[model samples]
Structure formats: structure tokens, C-alpha cells
Target: MILENEIGLSSFRNERQKASISILYTYGFLANCYEQFYKMHGMTNQQYNALRILRDQYPKPVSTSFLREKMLDKMSDASRLVSRLSAKGLVVVTQNPTDKRLVNILISETGHQLISDIDSDLYKLDDLMNGITEEEAVQLTSLLYKVRNSLKSTYDNTVTEEQVHA
Candidate 1:
């Protein structure tokens, strides 16, 4: 809705600007869904993402830097988020034995159980995509990848050209 208001998408739709507008609109919608999903657990989106990452890393310790790298948004403060999870007793943090300067993180038993309890609620989020069939989802994914790859190539070309000009 915000994208619709700000982007004035109706005019450019079905034209040259459609791809970019569609990407922006889709992101806005997905972000709203993310907000609603996290709200059910009284957690922020980043916090939920951190918890899920930790769950996937269960039985193995993860580093703050490693988490930052894996996060969907690179701007997130992984160290601070990990600290908050530790404070909530949902994660345990300790100094790495081999490298005192680095910290190791593990999902606490509480965190494991919490994720398990919320599994159903998380799946309920799939309803947001119910209008699309499985085949459509796959096609959407392929088109998205194509768009991303094209963008990446364009960016790389620009960077290389700039460097050459410099």
C-alpha cells in the first residue's frame, strides 16, 4: 500500500518501468507479511530471523560475524542481537576457546522449545501466497533470480567502468 501511494505504479505499470515497480511493490508486501508474522510471537523480524538461524545451527556454535553474514539484511547488528537473545535465555554465548577475542553462540534449550511451539503459526504465513499455485511460485522464483542476476551484472559493469574511468 505504501509502495502504491509513493511509487504511483498504475501509470508505469505494463510499461518500461514495470519490472522495477513490481520488485519494489513485492518487497513492500513481503515486509508487511514479515511484520505480521513476527508480531504473533511478540518479536521483531530480525529477532525471529536470528532465532531461526540459531535453531539451524543447533549443536554447533556460531560466531556473531558468521550470523551477520548469513542475515537477510546486512545492516543488522548481529552482536547486539545475539546479546539480547542471551539475556532472554534463548541463547548462550561464550568466549571461543581457541580465540579469546571471538565469541561462540548456541541456541538454548528454551529457544529450541519455543521454535517448536510456534511452528504451526509460522506455516500459517503461507496463506499470504495462497493466490499463487505451486507452479506460479516456481515461475516467480525463476523470474526473480533472473532479475537479480541482471541487476548484479549491471552493477558489476558500472563498477568496472567507473574504475577504468578513474
Candidate 2:
């Protein structure tokens, strides 16, 4: 169902309503797209994301903190996510040799194969952005970045409060 129909909100009243509707729809769409995108890989979105992060750091161990910084989902539990991948034999987590205080994560052979298999499928997922042209995608990214920068304080506060309550 359409968001307007589902929410019974024909039009927003003022800036507050516009912002709320934008946030709601943007989050909903991204979440739905993520669920569908990860389904094809036989993994949850978080698991897939962790695998990708490990791949990115291949030949170089990544710390939990580093993964946390790179993840799109700020709420993700890096330690738990790495543990889950380790359990699936998709990743390896070990105490850092140089720094015992830090844990290092690396992608496994199976993880590499899994990612390779999904590369082709990723094209289909990428196609979802076809709603906008290449230039538009760039502009949209710029706009999103600007918005995030402009509202950093408010966004951070909201997220921090949510996490505290959660």
C-alpha cells in the first residue's frame, strides 16, 4: 500500500510534517530494499554487511571499532555481528597479535566465494536506483550529505536518545 494511504495522511501541515514524512518514507524504502537485497545471499542484512566489511579489510585485520564506524546502520553490534559470521564460518575473529586488547576480523574463503557469487546479483539491486539518472544519483547523494551535515546535532541527539531508551 502507498504510504499516504497506509498512514491516512493526505498532506503534511508544515515543515515538521514534511520532515517526518520524508524520514518515514526514506527509512521504510531503504529497509525494504535492504531486506530484499540481502535475501538473495542467504544471509541477513547485517550479516551480509559484516561480510562485506571483512572483505574490504582483507589481508588487513579490522577492529570492531573500525567496522562500527564504517557501517551504515549505526545501531549494529559489531562484536555480535562478527561472532555470528564466525559461527557461520564466513569470518574469523581473533585477538590482535600486536594489540591483545583489540580483536581482529577477517573474511574467510567461504565469505569471499559468497561475495563473488553476489557480485552479479548486486547489479540487480543497484538497478533499484535507476529511478534516478546518474547525475541525479550524484545530486541526491550530495543533498543527503548536506542534510546530514546541517542537522547533525538534531539527528545525533535523536539517535542517542533512541539508543538510550532502547
Candidate 3:
């Protein structure tokens, strides 16, 4: 369905406005699919994201700060996610040897097993994107990167100028 029909709006101010709203709406739509998929396996999307990060770092512990920095949702509370995963035996947390105030996390064997299980069914989530062709997906990815670069440059300049004026 067209964005206008889906959102029940007759028109947008411009194509840029339409594109922006479509991106946001599509994100919410995709995020909901992810949320439901992860929920079935008894975890939030943030928790799954953390597990994947930890799995990649497997054997080598990572700081909660590292997880937060790498997470898809920047606003996620890494410490809380760690605590919950720990409670579920999905992760192991230990005090940082060099810094008592910091904790290091690692995915446990059970965590790895859960990930393996989820991987088998992951295609169901990927199928949501079957509406778009592989070439379109690549183009979409490049366009999204361009958008991020534009935003980042603008934001960096704004912050720098603000600091200078202050």
C-alpha cells in the first residue's frame, strides 16, 4: 500500500516529508516484527542484540558501556539488560579485574544454544523483506548510509559551532 493510503493522509508537504515519514513508519513496522519474533524465544530485541554482540566477543568479556555503544537502540539500558540476561542464565557477569566499579559480560553456553535455536527460525523475520528485491535492498542500504552521513555531518557541525559560541 502507498504511504499516503496506509497513514490515511491525503498528501504530504513534499516528497522529502513523505520519505521521512515512510522511513519512520517502516522502522516501527520492522521493529514490531523483530519484537514479536524475539518475544517468542523469551527475550526482548535489545537482549537479543546484546547476546549477538557478546557472542561475537565470546570468551572475551565486554563492558556494559561497550554493549551500549554497539547496541541498535542507543537508549537501551545496558546494565539492566545485563542483569536480566544474567538472571535468565543467558549471560555471565563478573567484576572487571582492573576496575571494581565496572563489570564484564560474556554469553554463556545456554546463550549460545539459544542463539543457535533462533538462527534456525530467523528466516521468518527475513521473509518480511521479501517484498523488496535483493538489488533494491542494496540500493536502499546505500541510500540509508547517505542519509546518515548527511545527518552526522550536519550534527557534528552544529555541535562544534555551539561549543565554540559557548
Candidate with best TM-score: 3
RMSD of 2: 4.2
Error of 2 at 63 (Å): 1.2
Q: Which of the two, 1 or 2, has more TM-score?
A: 1
lDDT (0-100) at residue 101 of candidate 2?
99
Per residue, candidate 1 scores C-alpha lDDT tens digits across 51-133 of 88989988899999989988987899998899888888989999999999999999999888877777768767778889999
Candidate 2 residue 100 C-alpha distance from true site, Å: 2.8
> Clashing residue pairs, candidate 2?
none
Q: Which lDDT tens digits does candidate 3 get at residues 1-166?
A: 3888999999999998998899999999999999999999999999989999999998999999999999999999999999999999999999999999999899999999999899899999989999999999999999999988998899999999999999
Q: Lowest-lDDT window of 10 residues in candidate 3?
A: 1-10
lDDT of 1: 0.84
lDDT of 2 at 89: 89
Rank by TM-score (best first):
3, 1, 2
lDDT of every model, 2 decimals = 0.84, 0.84, 0.95
The reply for model 1, stretches above 4 Å from the true place, is 1-10, 13-16, 156-166
